[model samples]
Target chain A: MAPTLGKRKRITRDELEQPSRPPSPSSASSESESDSEDVQDIFRRAFEAKFKPLEVDSKKPRVEEVNLELEDQEEEDSDWSGITSDEEEQVQVVEYSHLRHTGDRASKAEQRAFMSSKPPTLSGSTLFKTRPSTKAPADENDLTEASHLKNDVALQRLLRDSHLLSSTSTSGTSTPTLSAVGSQRHKSTDLHLLSLGAKSSIHAQKNMPMSHRIGISAKAKEREERRRAEAKENGVILEKERRAKKFTKERERGVGGPGVGKFRGGTLSLSKKDVRDITSSGGGRGGKGKGKRGRR
Target chain B: MTDETTQTLLKFTGHRHLPSRLLLSTLTGRPIRISQIRPNNVSRQGLQPHEVSFIRLLDSITNGSKIEFGMSGSTLVYRPGLITGSAEGLGASGGVLRHELGRGCEGRGVSWWIIPLCILSSFSKGHMNVIFHGEGCVTGAHPVSGDLSVDSVRTAILPLYKQFGIERDIELRVLKRSCAPSGGKSAGGEVQIVFNHQVRLPKTLHLLNPGRVKRIRGVAYAIGVGGSNNARSIESARGVLNKFVPDTYIFSDVSGAPFIQTPNDKNNPSGKKKGAVGFGLSLVAESSTGCLYSADVASPPEGGTTPEDVGRQCAYQLLEVIQQGGCVSRSAAETVFCLMAMGSEDVGRIAMGRDVIASENTIQLGRDLREFGGAGWGFRDKGEGSEEVVVSVVGRGVGNVGRKAV
Candidate 1:
C-alpha cells in the first residue's frame, strides 16, 4: 500500500509538470509481448471494478482525474491519428501507382514514400504511448476500422466542426444585428412553447370560454365607462358600483354552484338599469335600487 | 164832667184786666177808674191764651186782683163786675164799649187818653205805641251846652186803667257816681232810677195781670227819657235796654230815624269846630252798659277793641234772660241803637261801631235761641198774641236792672 501510495503521488506530480508527448505503441507493446493474456484480463478487471458500487466510492476521485488526463491525451492523439491515416492512405495509393508505372523515376517516388510513411510512424508512436499494450493494435485498427466506427467518428467530427464553425463565425462577425436575430429566434421559440403549454392547461380546465374570458374584460371596460357616464350624469356614485361588484362576487361564492352566471346576469342587468334610470332621472332610481339590493 | 174830663173817661172804657189797668195808671200818674157792668166770663174772643196769661201776670205784682174785661175789636173792654163775665154778654157789650171809648176820645181835648190805652195795650200784647217828643231840654248845669236834652215825650197807657189813680214810682238813686277827679273840671253824673211800688187794680178793671204790668212798665222806662238828655242820650239809654232788656218790647216814633253818628274828618277844622260834645258821653254810657250786662261778668281784655265781642256778650246776656223765661222784641230797637252807637265826632269810633253793629245784627236772636235751646226748647216767633208772657216779663225785669246799673 505504501509503495502504491508513493507511485500515485509521483504520477500526480508528473501529470501536472508534463506538457504532452507524441503517441507511440512501442512502450505499451512490451506488456502485450510478454503477457498478452494477463494484460487483457487486467483491463477487463479494471473496467468492471471501476463500475462496481463499492469501489466506485473509493476510486471516484482518481478515476475522475485519470479520465480528465485521458480525455486530453485522446484529443491530441485523435488529431495526430487523423493525419497519419490520411498519409498512410496516400502512400498506399502511390505505391500502387508506381508499380503500375514502370517507366517512372525511382528516387522521386521513394522520396514520396518516405515522407508519407514518416507521418504514420509518428502517429502510431503517439497512439502506442497513450493506449495500453492490449489496445495498441486496436488503436491502429481503430484507424482502419471506419466502416464499423465511421458514423460515431464522423458525427463527433461533424458536431465539433459545426460548433467550431459557428463559434468562429460568430466571433468573426461581432455585429449587433446578427446577435439580435439569434436572440430573437431563441426568445420566440421559448414563447411559442410557453403559449402551447398554457393552451393545453386551459383546455384541460374547460370551464371558462375563451370568448367569455376575453369579453369579460371588454364588458368590464364597457360597464366601467357606462358607470362613469352615469355617475357623471346622475351621480351614480363609484362607491355603489364597487359595493355591487363585491356583493355579486360574494353571492356567487355563497351558493356553492355555478351561480356566478346568474349572479353576474342579475347584478349586471340590475346595475345597468339602475345606472340608466339614475342617469335619466337625475339620481332618482338610487333610492329604489338601493332598497331592492339591500333586501336581496 | 167837662168835655175834656168826659173824654178822659173814655180812656177807662176798654180795660179788661185789673192789674194791667193799675199799671197803666201808675206809669202815667193818672186817675184810672174801672167798672164792670156785667158778670165776668172767660171768652175765647176776649184775649189769646198768651195774652190772657200776660194779663194775669199783673196779679203777681198787685198781690191779686180779680178783673174781667171783654175783648172788643181786639181790645179789652172793662166789664161791669169784678168776675169773669158770660161770653154772651161779653159779645153783646165789648164792641159797643170799645167803639164808644175810641170815638169819645177821638174828638175832644181828652185825646191824651188814647196814648195811655195804646201804651197799655202795647205792653200786654208785646207791641208798643211811641210819640216823639222834641229834642230833650238840656239843664243849664250841663258842662257842655248845646241841644243836649229832649224836652217832651208822649206817654202810652192801657185804656182800661185810665180811671184808676196809680202813680209810677220813678225814684233816682245814685248807685255810682263818676265825677271828674279833683282839680279836673267837669260836672257829669250817671244816675240810676228804680221803679219800686206795685199798683193794684181789680181783675174786672183790666184784662192784664200785675207781672205783665211790671214788665210793660220796665220796657217803657227803658225806652223813655226821664230827666233831660239829648235825643242821643235817650237813644243811648234805649241802646242799653236793647242790649240787656230781656222781656221788653220796643216801639219807635214814626218820624225818628234810627240814631246813626255822622262820619267826621278829624283833620277838617270845620268838623272839629262843629263838634257834638254829647257824642262821646253817649258812647261811653253804651259801652259801660254793655259791660254791665255781659254774661261772663268779667272785664273785657284791656284795649281789646273787638266790638263783636261786646255785642256777643250783650247777646249772651239776652239769651240768658230768655232761657230764664223772658221775651224781648229788640229787632227795631237794636237796628236803631246800632245806628246811634255808630254816630260820633270821631270818624274812627263811628266806623268801628258801625262794623260791630253790622256783625252783631247778623246774629239773629231767633236763630241763636234755636241753636242754644236745642230741639223742643227753642222759642219760635209766634207773631203777636202767642208768645209766652213769662219770657217778656223776665226779659223786661233783667233789662231794667241792667240799665240802672249802667
Candidate 2:
C-alpha cells in the first residue's frame, strides 16, 4: 500500500455532511444525460472514502484514531447497503480503486464486522470475549504505535514510569514496589503486566505486517543500548570479552575502604631489581622457552 | 506439585547420603519417610544444620512442597513438589528477559547439591540462570560442605555434560570467590550459573580410552598471602608433574582475605586476617584423546597444608585420576555416573581403569539410581586389570515433566 502521505482520496463537502446516508444496491440504471449530478455524487463519496480517517475530529477530543477509523468504516458499509446495481458497481469500483493501494480490504471488512458484532468497552475484557483472532498484545502494540505517531503524551508518561521502575529494579532489590505494581496490574487486566503465555494467532495482527507484528528485530536499535546496559548485569559467559566499555571494569566489587581484604586478592611485593631478575633471566608467567629436559 | 496420597514412600535408615536421596526423591516426585535417622544414636539423631539448609534450599525453588518431622527430629516426612521454573522470572520485563534460572543460598554440601541441580537442568524447558549466595563455596574438601568449586565444575563436569548432549551455552561462573567458614564478612563469594535445557535425553558418554597424558594446567590460590606463596606452590607442583607431563603451567593468584575480628588473636582459626594466611591449588591433566582429569588440595584451619604440600598433593591427585585410565576423574566420577544412569532411555558408557575403583560415594550413588527406577543397571567391571573397564547402562528415560511448556 502507498504510505499515508501519498495517494489520498479527497472528499467533497456532500459526503462529509451526510456520512450516515446508506448506499443502495438498486440505484437507477438509466440513461446518463438525466442524472449528470450523480457523477459528482460518486466523486464526493469516493473522496470521503479515501481521506475521512485523516480528518481532524472537531467533535469529541478523546476518541482514539482506532475507533475513528472503525466508525468511518461502519458508515461506508451502511452507505453501500442502499445503492442500486449500476451505481453499486460505480461505488465499488471507486472503493476497489482506493483500497487496492492500501492492502487487505478483507481485514477492513473483518474489523468492521468485529466492531459491529461486539460493543467496544472502556474497560479491558477477559480473553474469552476478545475478538476471535486478535490477541491482547496486538491491541496494546497498536495503541502504543498510535501514540508513538507524534510525541504520544500518554506513552511518554508510561515510558518514564517504566524506565524509573526498571532502573530501580536493576540498581538493587525492589521486591515490594514490583509486588505493588503487580497487584495494581492484576486489579486492571493489562495483558502485558500479566504473565500469561497465550499463544498468539494471526487474525489479531493481520493489520500489521509480520515485521511489525513480531516487534523483535526491528527494535534492535533500541535493544542494542539495553544489551550494553545489561552486559553490566550479573555476568555473561564469554570466551573473550571484547574491550567494550562494559567488560573493562571488574565485576566482583571490593570491601569498603581499608576494610578487610585488599582490592583484588593480593599482590606480590617484588622490587624493581627482583622483577628484572625474573623477567631478564627468562623466568615468570607465560613461559615461552622449552623446559630444561633432564637427561632421563 | 504431586499428590501425597499417590506416593508409595521410599524409606531409608539414617541421615547418611541424604542429599542424594532427597535429590532423587525430588526428581522422581516421590514422597519419602526416614524413620531411624540416627534413631540408634539418640543424641545426634536429628538432621544437621547443613542437611536442614539443603531442605530450605530445595523449598525455595519449588512450589507446594511440604516437610514434617516426627519422633523427636528422628523420623522425617517429605512430599515432593513441582520445580518452579525461575525464582525471578526474566529478572524484569525487557533488559535481559530470556529465561529464569533461580536464586537460593546453597549453605553447604554445594558440591553434591550442584550435581542433582545440573541434572535437572538437562530436562528443564528453557535456559536457567541461577544465582547462589552465602559462604562455604570456595573452600577445600570438607565433610559437611563438599569441595568442588566453580572452577572444578567448569573444567571437569561440564565436559561430561557436553558428552551427554547439553553442549551449548553452559557456564559455571564464580562472580566472587569465598572460602569456607565465612563469619559474617560479606555475601560469601557469589556465583551465577546459566544452564540450557532441551527436550531430548542426554547422549551416551562413551569415553573408551583416555590415551596418555600430554599437558597439565593448574591454578595456585593464596588468600591474604603474598604472591610468592602461590608461586612457591606452583613451582613445587611442577617438580612432581613435570616428569610425566612436560607442558605444565600453574597460574598464581593472590587474593586478599576477609577480616575476622575475634576476642583475641589466638582464637582466630583460618589465619586469613589474623596473619596465618590461606593457600590452595588445583590441577587438570589433558590426555592425547581430549579427556580431562582434575584434583584440588587446600590449606587446613590450623595453618597446615603448606604451599609445597598443596601443590605436590594436587599434582599427585591428578596422577591418581589419570592412572585410573578412564576419561573421568575420581571427584567427578560420581556425578558422571548419575547423569548417565538417570538420563533418557539410551545406552551410556564410561571407561573405568583398575588404577582406581569407583569411590564408595559413587557406588552408593549407583545404588541410589537403582532405587529411583533405572532398572537393569549396575557397575560392571569389564576388565580384570590392564585395559580400562567400561561401565555401560540403558536408562529408564525418566524425563522431568515439572518444567512446563514456556
**TM-score of each model, paired residue for residue:** 0.14, 0.51
Lowest summed lDDT window (length 10), candidate 1 chain A = A115-124
lDDT value, residue B247 of candidate 2? 62
Chain B TM-score, candidates in order = 0.20, 0.83
Interface Cα root-mean-square deviation for all models: 99.9, 29.6
DockQ of predicted candidate 2: 0.00
**Model 1 per-residue lDDT tens digits across residues B60-103:** 22211334454432444322112111112332232111111111
The ten-residue window of minimal lDDT in model 2 chain A covers A115-124
| Distance from true location, Cα of A105 in model 1, Å | 99
lDDT of 2 by residue, A95-204 (tens): 44321111212243333322221211111123334566645656777888876875665454455456445655676766435322654443323434332554543224
- What lDDT does model 1 reach? 0.28
Alpha carbon lDDT of residue B222, candidate 2? 70
